[model samples]
Target: MFEIKDNHLAAGDLLAEALAKVPGIRHVKEVNDLSDIDKPTATPCLFYLYYGDQLTDAANAGANMQLKQTWLVVLAERKGSKQAGTNITATIRAIAGKMTGGAGPWQRVNTPIKPKYTNGHAFYPLAFTCQMRFKGALK
Candidate 1:
């Protein structure tokens, strides 16, 4: 059998699994638009995954092509209390450590720790750039 695997989607699945383990993260899902961001009903943290820098090539004897891409893990924490948002971001940092040096396949990059303020709310964002390699082909 033959198959075309999506490296970016695979990386995202791995990242989402890693984040679900963290207690402070309430909701996690792939995000395309920022205006409709909604917090998790069970928790205060909302996460969105965006993919960028996708590159692929098909230059081999077989019908398969090389694939690589980047994933952005954006975290938005609502500040219900004075220290609520702080606690959420701290958990995000720890998740980064696990993704970069732990058992995850993705490598973490340098991103700003500053929180963007809008509508009287605090939004913390973190992005992980993952370089993945795979062979993909369409039938």
Candidate 2:
């Protein structure tokens, strides 16, 4: 059997690394809450969280497992500047481009959500999913 925690960490790390390379993204982290995000330091940042998982298939009397895991990535940028919208759009496309080729194990499951403007910030959420398959018994 495979360790789920390790897989989760690897997947999250992979995404974080990829997003970090995107232009205009200054910070990338796994966040528990959006309300507490610091706009100044983390603006033009990407925050991701593991949403949930589902078992899609199983075989070999439980020795093999196929699971689908989902993650949510939020892009936060400071609003007010005329280029804020343009920057957001560029970042979105860059992110989508990164996801288009497929990372180690993660895939962009759906289109990014519309940006929500509030409190001098614009937030765009993107969803990604991955399929994890574990076969054989643990050592």
Residue-level lDDT of model 2, residues 1-139, one tens digit each, is 2235435545666667767776766788887665555464757777887777778888888777878667788777777656566655655555453442244345566744566787787777777776666565754
Best by lDDT: 2
TM-score of 2: 0.70
Candidate 2 residues lying further than 4 Å off, grouped into runs, are: 1-7, 38-40, 80-105, 111-115, 135-139
TM-scores of the candidates are 0.62, 0.70
By summed lDDT, the worst window of 10 consecutive residues in model 2 runs over 96-105
lDDT of each: 0.54, 0.65
Off by over 4 Å in 1: 1-8, 38-43, 54-68, 84-90, 97-103, 112-114, 137-139
Q: Candidate 2: deviation at residue 57, Å? A: 1.1
The TM-score between candidate 1 and the true structure equals 0.62
Q: For candidate 1, lDDT tens digit of each residue in 22-59? A: 66666677667655554444445556565564445555
